[model samples]
Target chain A: MITYDDEVVCAPRAGTLYDVLELILDRGMVIDVFVRVSLVGIEILKVDARIVVASVDTYLRFAEACNRLDLEHDVRSKTVPEMFGSPVAKTVGRAGARRTARSLTDKVRDVLAPEHEEAAEAEARTRERAERPRSRPAARPRGEDDRPRSRPRRRTETEDE
Target chain B: MTAPTTTAPESAPESAPESAAAPKALYVYGIAPAGIRTPRSRGVDGAPVRLLTEAGLCAAVSAAPPRLRPRRRDLLAHQAVLDELAEQGPVLPMRFAVLSPRTDTLLTQLRSDAAHLTQQLDGVRGCVELNVKGTVVPGHFADLVRRDDRLRTLALQTRRRPDYEANVRLGEAIALGVRREARRAAREVVDRLAPLAVRTVQGATDDEQVLSASFLLRSADEARFREAVAERARACGDRLALSVTGPLPCYSFVDPRPASPAGR
Candidate 1:
């Protein structure tokens, strides 16, 4: 019974984290003073990574998904998400757009904010030496140091090292 | 939505800093100042990328045990960490699953690259990333079919015959027409957006995600960019849906993962 319309609850559009996500985790300053921790399961992210909805396939899929959404039965037209069982799959095109928009606004607030700077300082070396190199690069552009943030100050996380 | 403290909900309360542990590692998603929140979501492996600030700047990082690889939950985790960081300022995002072998090395790298890092940070100071996507809307086919006389006659003839084989052929033809239109529209999108971008990067495109692109713009450019997007939407609304997202932290322009002498 759930169709793409139900996506309103999950992703409103692809612009959510899906759009600028490449920018946030992949861009910016890499100070020579701090270490970047490697994340686990980052390689699988690339191969299985589903692109945001913006394709003809998506249009057809959307049409098909819409077709599945019984528009006829509403005594008083129901909210779109209510039509779909799972409204939050992180990949729904429309839902992603709304979420990404909201997230960007929040990022701006955080950046201009001089308040949280202290908290960021406290954990400067916190995750040092978590994991290391074994996988291919991310589907998104990432700064060079993909090593586990938990890596110690002495060596890289690659087992070979 | 925001990850400010370790106690934040997304990531499990991670173990302490593992500076000396062999298997221990730190996960750095992006850099920011010390004033922001610790994202509620953790990085890949569900290990939180917490804030680590020094010399006025902060790094969002997490603890890693060892031998990390890509997994479904982990990819989401990486995405989540950066998601939280974007709320701060321009985050120098790292690729997914990049692990540093040691803390000393990381700190040293950050220090060595401090000037460059600062410059990169400044580069995106008041800027954010915006991704404007344009997809071929199937509705355009109606117009295309009407405009093409050869196709119109063929369609009329097919309609008169009205057989399963005929329908399939008609549908196939329509699909082809749609593809041709989509490809043309894609070229047009790149042409239109390229001039407005301070930096432009192409993103991956699948059947569902078409016209994948990222643009870095100054904060003030938000208005002009939106105006351009609006104009594009009006111009191509029938054939494509042009949607713009952002005014977010500059995440695509940072890369100083200084390669070690041997790796380079």
Candidate 2:
């Protein structure tokens, strides 16, 4: 049984860049004569944007938050107030949810940007070394490395065309 | 985020030579009826926006930018120009980064496609696009975990063992529960709000954001529609957080390519 709250009703607000991004990028008219520039990094940006959701990291974060709950307390009585009563749960509430949700595009933008790629690569290397050897090593890093490398290759291909 | 630096070097080089030769390609923002006021807002790269009219239709355009990336400023500039046009009357917004190689070609296109373009403008007339995005709230997630015997059992098991693998499994189960509730709320929201809209276009939804939908509604109905959204938001507030952005130019409602006269 979900409860309703006044705070959850966000006013109709002006759209942010992420809010209107797909509309601007994918929707609207594109005439045949018009040249729609093969925007470099857009694919990478989009892929990275969607990747943040449903990832193992996000699952882990969710589990960690839930683990802090005092399960001995009557679950039926527990609601938003009780969740917010705990300092840990308060951090995982509204503000945190909005931040996590909206951060996808920003994260994508940061991850796809060339400067951030180097930093991300360094971080990934360190993370890989620190974590237990995983089965899907080839799959994860390949996607990241491919974007930066393929960008240059795409430019050359377009030039030749 | 870093200040809007110019796009990377590799992209700059290719576009540079082409820009040097010509006056500049026209970066089209949108199509409108001829005689609308020139947009005061800056175009992409802060270019001065002007209009090109032909066959009773006008395309709000600026000098073609040297390089076009989906930079934050440029994307906002594109929306701003269309928004300015949309205030005056109907506009058929061009997708971001659309450029005409030459002004002559653009004029020719406007002339040839006038009927189709005008029809598209009419389709969106008196309507605004309200995009509603709903994200998982996780407020009632504890209730879910408690209600489901499997989840409760898993929680107890994980608490007892407290190993990394157990924690991951427990976390994954909680994540699924959170998303399932949010997604359920998302469906109910869309169902409730769909009636108020003339048309509804669903956008991509991921695990965190269970709903991303654009609703096209008459300007007159906008208030009622918003009230309904607020109601739904309150009803599902604990499981999903809803945000509405609107009175926007009808970007999602617009056709990507207007049917050519021959096809029509």
Candidate 3:
């Protein structure tokens, strides 16, 4: 029932380095002989990628976002991370990051209640194809007009990649 | 950006070296076993990756001349080539932007390190790599809050006395609660899938997505494993967005060196 596009947005992920850093770096063959190429940016890359999830700021932000929801609706307000376009979850400014998350939480409701999203997606996809040809999973894959660029969204390399 | 690391899609005819006699550098991707299909495309660098097949081994190599530095295209080129090769068989993927002094050095690597390479290939022979990604599912937070009386009490109490700081605190608590739920689901996914794997490799993690481990499974177990993934997907639909990648050649599973006597 899931098309590549649906799967693109929802499928269980497959094997990629991003998915197996432990197996490759920690578990796989580490021959002491062959010079393990001292990659320049690898350590930093790994460090940045695995930023700890627990932060007071995060808690405050979560609290902030939760405040906007219906307490009795039983609809758990989705965290912004759910709105991520790519695997990378880089929240640069704390305040903006929290607001952006509303979209993702909002999406959960839309996904579960599909009729509207189907129409929205059809329209979104057409508009998407017209503008940005490379709209990746990157967030904010739009143009200068702030009109929501298409495919190739910007995945982070800053606090995230 | 194209999810598959595809930057440029070129018809990789000869792979870099054959185009040579010139000094243009070729970007290197990962290495796959010999006889597996060459990727349907080229390295993100736009160079063709020629296979220098040796005794049961093939290096998915491209030419890299001097003055070559890592560019986004080149890194993506490297990823794309390996992605292509991985579709067929096990690949010993090089890190992004690895350049040899010349094709001669790479060949020398293949020639001298032939035994090591073969052993590396054999290590991943009957295995496939599967990547699992877990992202936080926001909807789960409400479920958690409702289920946990303690959290519900806190939510009600916070609602009654709502203030800027209080709301932030409540939201933060809820966020923490949601993340905990997500992390738990992530663990469950790993534990359940681990049984089907020969070995597992974990990648670094970040906040939004848990780009965790790859399970190297027995080729036969792939189906069962996929079935399990579907089950997991359905079961944990709202807690975590679980996406599975590949029956790929053991790119992450293969060793870079020849096995030592002890390792053997």
Candidate 4:
């Protein structure tokens, strides 16, 4: 079994607009007479948000983490505590295992922040969170300190398709 | 942002290119019983919102913004209006970007659909929607590697071969295994929580988001529901990460023409 901070992992976040975007956009009522205007970049927003993990990129990353593991050890004798203490744990932890484990809200934040600099900054922040021994998802709901103060423009508005 | 023209304008001329921005058009936010205090929340494009009451039902509306885009602020405003209305009484939230061509047209629809809309509103009275989303957590790699013989064998082979193809194969297997575990945990979560809700609606799920479901819960039961979610989050924190988002307006439960029951 894997061990981590329950406070960080188990606490339910208050919902932000991003958390309920699907509900706002897709689930509400529509009168046949009233027009539902077609949005310019919303298709891309919706599509990018629902990305699946079954890809060569994900597979390669997983294989890379597995290669760094200590598979030569006797599985029967090895225990959870020893596994956690081993260099194997550090290898897997550092090798994008946490990256694969990111929550959907984090991906939505990345997709919404389209500026290259902002995206890179967001990436660095995500890495920082991943490297922490126990940390919450990178994007907190609306009023958190996770977003950089410098991000003024709504970059997601400019995305095409 | 380029303005997207309305798909089919009921009364606008074919020659008119910008009918959507016409001053006569009203952006409809939601419907509720008449006489609830007007929502103080701003509408899309920062327009002030008001109610157009007809046939005992009223819609929260505003002069349609000249240009409509799904900007973050506008979306929040739309939700805020419905949320405020929901606090007062049952509300039927319109999907974002719904625009009525004219006040008369909106009033006609309100009159025609009052019985159905009121019934729909009653279904969700005193209840709130709570959405639960669960994602895969690959934190159990050590445990998985130990328990699965095939995965262990692949890990061993990849270490020896150390080739690109071999790594991809090993990694693909691991990803699949991790997703499968998370999916199982997601099912267990829904099964555990569904009983606490009056009704449940399952949303689309992909490999990464193993589960996304909304529960229409009574206001009094919201605490019990949240406690149940917290317990499940603790139970499966290793394999799946769960987050709850709501007490929101009942967006998923407001369909007048309800979809066939799919949630189990």
As for TM-score, the candidate ahead, 3 or 4, is 4
Off by over 4 Å in 4: A1-14, A72-161, B1-23, B256-264
Q: In model 3, how well does chain A match by TM-score?
A: 0.35
Q: How does each model score on TM-score?
A: 0.56, 0.74, 0.61, 0.73
Candidate 4, residues B1-264, lDDT tens digits: the string is 322333233444344344434436788899999999999877877778889898999999987777788887888889889889988988998899988877667777888777788888899989989888877766566567757999998888788789888988887888889889889989999999999999999998888778889999998888788778767765665567676777788889988333332121
Query: Considering summed lDDT, which 10 consecutive residues are worst modelled in model 2 chain A?
Result: A152-161
Candidate 3 per-residue lDDT over residues A70-89, each given as its tens digit: 45754323233232221222
Chain B only, TM-score of each candidate: 0.74, 0.88, 0.78, 0.88
Provide the lowest-lDDT 10-residue window in model 1 chain B.
B4-13
DockQ (CA atoms), all models: 0.10, 0.22, 0.14, 0.26
lDDT by residue for model 4 (A1-161), tens: 11222222212222556567789999998887778888888887676566665677667756755654556653322222112222212212221111112233343233223244445444543554454332222111222222223432222332232
Stretches of candidate 2 exceeding 4 Å from the true structure:
A1-14, A47-51, A55-57, A68-161, B1-24, B261-264
What docking grade applies to model 1?
Answer: incorrect
- lDDT of candidate 2 over B45-87, digit per residue (tens): 8878888889999999887666778776788889888888988
Q: What is the TM-score of chain A alone in each candidate?
A: 0.24, 0.38, 0.35, 0.39
Clash totals in order = 122, 1, 46, 1
At residue B127, what lDDT does model 4 achieve? 90
Worst 10 residues of 1 chain A by lDDT: A133-142
Using TM-score, give the best candidate's number. Answer: 2
